[model samples]
Target chain A: MHPRRWTEFAIESLIRVLGLSSIGFVLLIFLFLLKEGLPAFLQVPPENLLGTRWYPTFDLFGTLPLILGSLLVTATAISIALPLGVATAVFVREVAPGWAREVLKPMIEVLAGIPSVVLGFFGMTVLAPLVRETLDAPTGLTAFTGGLVLAYMALPTIISVAEDALDAVPKSYRDAGLAMGATQWQTIWRVVVPAARSGILTAVMLGMGRAIGETMAVMMVTGNAARMPTTIDSLFRPVRTMTATIAAEMGEVARGSTHYHVLFGIGIILFVITFVLNLVAAGAIFKKRRRGGLR
Target chain B: MRPKIRVDHLSFYYGDKQALFDISMEIRERQITALIGPSGCGKSTFLRCLNRMNDTIPGTRLEGRVLLDGQDVYAPGTDVVDLRRRVGMVFQRPNPFPQSIFDNVAFGPRVLGLCRGRDELEEVVERSLRDVRLWDEVKDNLKQDALSLSLGQQQRLCIARVIAVQPEVILMDEPCSALDPIVTLGIEELMKRLREQYTIVIVTHNMQQAARVSDWTGFFWLGRLVEMGPTGDVFTRPQQKLTEDYITGRAG
Candidate 1:
């Protein structure tokens, strides 16, 4: 028996153990969420979750407002972030030259690396004031401010994802377009952008998922009123999202109470929204691969 | 007509490194001129110089005249777009856009605005695809993805794309390097057919290919034009010691 073969065996066993440990951790998180979330649903009746009003204090937790609020905030954030984020990504990857690329890349990295609390504070101080001043409102914290902050926070993800997507298109594609006598701008618009469509979709969906899952930054900005929004303009008003509801009420609501259980239910809603968004991202990636398949 | 191209004491520099020397050549109208040399002997660089494709690379400077039909291609007033449109190029790798087979053939015609109506455009595309002998195989599958084609088919598609534009001159940079022997022969035959209408210049490492396909052969050595003449003269008779050793397989 050679010592080299023993070394190979050891390395192989280590890789297997490491892979299983990762899977075990993901399984643990899924099981924990399922176990804690399932019982609360069983204890709380369907009318409590789906009925007209939302009042969970008397062993009846209606989840309508929280669900609506979460949808509103996530959709608003995505609407604002997508265009600006993708444009910045294109500028950084294509239009920006050497010194600009060097400067912009690290700045985006720092934006991504900043602590969420610090971002929340910045949102609290800067963005909220801007929104308040523009809207002529008393409260700086509103859904608009929260959405702005989340867009700012998710900017790095969108830019990096879209940049990687644009970069993955081979240089030959660009060269082919150029050699066809197409202008630079025309080539970028017609050939490069269309080729990167699925990739850009994935980036947008990933950013959407991230914005929806965001907690601290969004919580610090949105006014957290928990009212059912009437008009689209009211999106800028104080609104308590599901995550915000959980954060604001989970501690005060005692254990086994309907309010506490409903907060847990809000967690389930947030998890579901994020899960759907991620599934959309995965589907876009699959479609891109299918279209760009090896023949 | 005028000579299709003229190179006089043409030299090129890649950064501080010089790639082409005081090499001069002329491409007459409707002729297939083959450039042959060992690897890294500036043959490809000289071929690229014709269409100013080398302008894409930064820090590359050229001091020469690349006159297409006596019009200076290096002249500042010369529009690169118009020049490239008139002088199409095909790469060694057969790079077709990730598009439908029809779109790939239609790309150049669309860019040049060669046809106004859809029927005329389709007719041109069909004719171009037929010219390279790929229309019969791909006519039914025009809507299929270009990437779905095999390597040999893709190379032919690229050739079809160049002809679709109806360019006066075509530059082929080792077009058959990535294909099998049968495909290479097919392309060689296609080149024979294409030479009647388009002036073709190609770089090939295969000496036999140059001998078989080209009327004129230019031998490059260490960035210098060692010798150039009719393919028969270069292959049968020795003009220079280097050309003799190289063609005879004795020395590079």
Candidate 2:
């Protein structure tokens, strides 16, 4: 074989290996998680594992409160972020003048690049006290405070993705709407936004994925109480998340103990949730492409 | 017949470059007026000028007057939305909102608040679809996504969407350019039928289409009107040398 052919073969093999290695790594992580975490599910009684308490020293290990805490904080974050992000995206994409759009887009991208730890620090210092005073809650660090921080962290993702979706709508749709006597607002709401619905929904799902997987900001502000958030008022009360529990206890946990395995169990659960969210987001994007291609 | 729209020394500029030179013409009420020209000869730009659609583009400037029903549409404080409602437009390609067929047609009436209630809105949608002769074909599938329709049907739906607002004039900019010959014939036939109620101004690259459908035809060359007259005379006995050359395939 020629030397050129040998070099080509080497490059192709190297590329294939690099591509396959990511899948290999993901599978290895899943297998490792299952091997360590599966024992907790089997050894611990189902009632104990699924109970309300998460007292590790006393071997309680119920993940119900942690799971609920994560859901409450993430749901609050999304509820706050979705509307604000989508509105900002519309303003930037459809309403802003060219120079303003050029300036605003880069600023939003810069916002997304801010470290999550810094946001967490800000939440710990500024947002928690504000929430505590505003709501007159007993403590500042609560699910609501955590949600506010997460919402800010997730805003840039939602805005940029939704803006791209709105931008992808064909220019002809706007012309048609305007030609029919619709005002700019009417055209955007009735035609352009509706046309980009699936893409916008995908953006929301991806933002939710980012918010749910986030650890640092949530852990800092959510006053790790490990209590069930059963009442509506629990939104303003201290709660611990699955992620915070794993992060906080992993350092002192005895190796291969059931408590350590339970933490791994929480990791598996988080991975599954974000994986499903990304799948749904992908599905929405696929649907948008199919509809877009039809014309 | 009185002119529904009158253009007096109209000129348009996009930023530093002028697009349309001083061009003047009359669009008679309930008549089909076609502008035939080569690509980039300013026919579409002139058509957009009638309804002030050019205002949507950034850094574009228009001088001279476009009067609709003897009212200057470009005058200060002229309600652009109202002017566009009076004069609707169809584009080169069919552009339906990514929605159901019913919603696509009803969009205009809903936005303009022309209908009193759901029943009236439904009546308007049905009437508009019938006007475009698309009711029978799409009535069974009004709930289906508009994108699911064939290109010809989508174009017809776009026409339905425009007429649902009940405009006094319809401006078509190469409305059939994206269509097949058969589909183009269908649209042309619709334009003729539409002329009974609304004044129509069409810009077409196909001289044969202008000859077939328009009562009054204007020939544009290089941003200027070379000739304007009855379609028969313009096609058969064009007075200007440029018009004659263009009609005889001698020069663009």
Candidate 3:
């Protein structure tokens, strides 16, 4: 081969290796988790593994409360985030003046740069006390507190992604709407939003994932209670998530102990949930693009 | 001929940059008036001014008066949304919304609340589609996506979309520039058919297209109206040296 051709081939091969190594690392991690986690499932019978109570010290290892806790927090965070984030995105991309947009875009990026630990500290110090005093609850630390903090955390992701989607809609669509005598708001709602539907869905899914996998902030504010929520007003009640369980208990447990293996098992479950969320998002995007291309 | 729309000493500016100098013209009712010029000579700008489409752009200003039926369209508190409904526009490129064919045509009427019932809306949609001569081909596939149509069909659909609102006048900005020669001819035929009911003003870079379809023609050069008259008189009878030179292919 010519010298330039040989150089190109070598560079291409190196790039491919670098690109594939991350996927390889993920597979290795999954295999290792399975090795550690599957043993705990064998030691703890199926009934105990799937039980509602989760007293790990007394040999009860049901994770239903933790799973439900994560679901409730994530769903509440998304409900709060989706409308606020999408509306802010529309304001930034479509309604704001040039200077306001310039200022807001970077300000939102700065919000993303805030550390999770600092956010956890803020939630513990600021939001918890406010929640307790305002609602006149026994304690400030509750699922609602965790959810509010998580919603704030997820806003940056949703706003930026949804703004990009809104921006991607063609200029002609707006003009067509306006020339048809539609008001500016009507045009934005009827034309621009629908055109960017797939992208907005992606934003919501990503925001949900961020809220679901969050550990430190949720743990700091949720009071780490490991019991089933008995009341309809359980959002104001203390709860603990699977992620928090792993983070709080993993370091002190003896190596190769059932507790250690159980932490790994929780890790596997978290990984599987995130994986399924991503797969569902990818499938929806794929279907949308295929239908879009068919025309 | 009685003038349907009149422009008196109009000028336009986009952020301190003058795009149109003093211009005046009369557009007759149920007649086609063609504005012909080279690229960036302000023919399209003048066309957009007719319906205040330029108001959408930031930092743009209009001077002088534009009267529709002797009522100043640019007067204070003149309703822009209502003005657009009366004076509809078709863009250079075919821009159909990503929606069903039936929905695309029905969008204007539905949004403006023009029809009282579903049957009335369906009739308006069918009539508009038939007016554009597209109903025969697309009648069975009304539920299909509008983007699934050919480019020619999309342009016709856009025209039908405009027609559904029942505007008194239509502004077309180089409406056929994106289509092929055969499709352009078909659009020209449609334009002639549409002229029987609606007053039409078209801006085109193609002088041949202007001469072929227009009853009255105006030549614009460097934001200024050089000459305008009956198409035959402007093309055959030599008047202004610049106008004659432009028609003879000596100047633009």
Candidate 4:
């Protein structure tokens, strides 16, 4: 073989190894999580592991409240975010004039730059007090506060992604709709939005993932109350998410104690949930792009 | 034949760049008026101006008048939606909505509320498809995606979509440019049939096509209409040196 061929082969192999090593590291982390967290499932009884209460000090690690807390916060954030995000996207991409698009895009992107901790701090000081005063709740630090902050945090992702989706829809589609006597708004809703449906769905899923996986902001505002969310009114009440539970208690627990294992178990659960969500989003995006290619 | 549309001293501009020079023409009702020109000579621009499609582009301006049935279409209260419904357009490329075949044809009628209900809408779709000579092939697969059809079929679907609105005037901008020669002939045949009901304005780079399908032909050269006459006279007689040179393959 030529000497140049040998050099090329070596460089290609080196790059291939670099790419494969990242996957190897991910597998190693999953293995380590399983080793540390799987022990808690064996140590604690099944009922306690799946119970409603989460008093770790009382030897109770029922994750139901924590799971519900996360779900309620994430769901609330999504409900608040989806419509606003998609609307903002449409406004920015389709309705806004050129100068407005230039100003609004950067401003929305700037929201993504604010630190999560700063958002949490803002939630604690500004939003929590406002919520307490306005709704006359006992405390301002509640799941609703967390959700509001998370919704703000997730807006940039949803808006930018949905904007990109709308932008990707061919100009010809708009022309066809317009030439067919449809009004601009009607054309955008009936034709352009449907054409970009898959991309918009991907945007919503990604926004949901961002809301669900967020920890610091949620931990700061949710009041860290590990209680069962029994009623619709509990959305404004204090609650603790699985991520918050792990973040707040991980440092204090003994290294080899069952408490430490339980925190790791929560981490594993978070990992699995996010992993599944990301996978589903990826599959949906791939399918949509493939269908778009047929056009 | 009666004059269906009249353009007087029309000039178009995209921002500061002028696209169409001052031009005047009369499109006859139930007749095919073909505008033949080289690429970027403003034939399509002039076609779009007929129905105000250029309004969608920001910073574009038009001077002078385009009258449809003696009504100034560019008047302040002209109601553009109604103007578009009356003067529907077909593009150079087949741009079928990514929807079912039936939905694609029914889009215009449904949006305009021209049909009263589902069966009426179905009737319009079938009639429009039949007019385009595509109903026999597409009727069985009306629920399938429009993008699933061949390019030739998609163009026919687009024509059907435009016809479904029952427009008085049809503007086709190089409508056969994307199809094979055989499919092009089929579209030409369909255009001839359609002209009996709707006044047709077509922009084509193919000069032979202008001679073949059009009753009247306007030769455009660099944003200006150089000559206008019956297609036979334009093809056989030497009027302007430029028009004669173009028809003889000596000039663009």
List where candidate 1 sits over 4 angstroms from the true fold.
A1-22, A58-64, A136-140, A290-295, B110-121
Per-residue lDDT tens digits for candidate 4, residues A1-295, read: 9999999999999999999999999999999999999998899998999999888899999988998899889989999999999999999999999999999988898888899999999999999999999999999989899999999999999999899989989999999999988999889998998888878888888898989889999999999998898887899999999888888898799998998998888888888888888899888778766665323
Q: Kindly provide the TM-score of model 4 when superposed on the true structure, using C-alpha atoms.
A: 0.95
**Clashing residue pairs found in predicted model 3:** none
TM-score of chain B of 2: 0.99
- Write the residue-wise lDDT of candidate 1 on B1-252 in tens digits: 446898989999999999999988888789899999999999998987887778777689998798898889999888887788788888889888888999888887887688999999999999999999999999999999888799999999998988888889988999999999999999999999999999999999999999999988999999999998888999999699999999989976
**Where in model 3 is the C-alpha error above 4 Å?**
A1-20, A229-231, A293-295
What C-alpha lDDT values do all the predictions have? 0.83, 0.92, 0.91, 0.92
Q: In candidate 3 chain B, where is summed lDDT lowest over 10 consecutive residues? A: B231-240
**Higher-lDDT candidate of 1 and 4:** 4
Interface RMSD for each candidate model? Answer: 1.7, 1.5, 1.4, 1.3
Candidate 3 docking DockQ: 0.60
Q: Per-residue lDDT of B1-252 in model 2, one digit per residue for the tens?
A: 898989999999999999999999998999999999899999999999998988999999988999888999999999999999999999999998889999999999999999999999999999999999999998999998898899999999999999999999999999999999999999999999999999999999998999999999999999999899999999899899999999999998
DockQ of 2: 0.76
| Pairs clashing within candidate 1 | none
Q: For model 2, what is the C-alpha lDDT against the true structure?
A: 0.92
Query: What tens-digit string does per-residue lDDT give for candidate 3 at B165-234?
Result: 9999999999999999999999999999999999999999888998999999999999999888998888
Task: Give the TM-score ranking, best first.
Answer: 2, 4, 3, 1
lDDT per residue for candidate 2 within A215-250, as digits (tens), equals 888899999999999987999999898889999999
Query: Fnat of the models, one by one?
Result: 0.38, 0.82, 0.58, 0.62
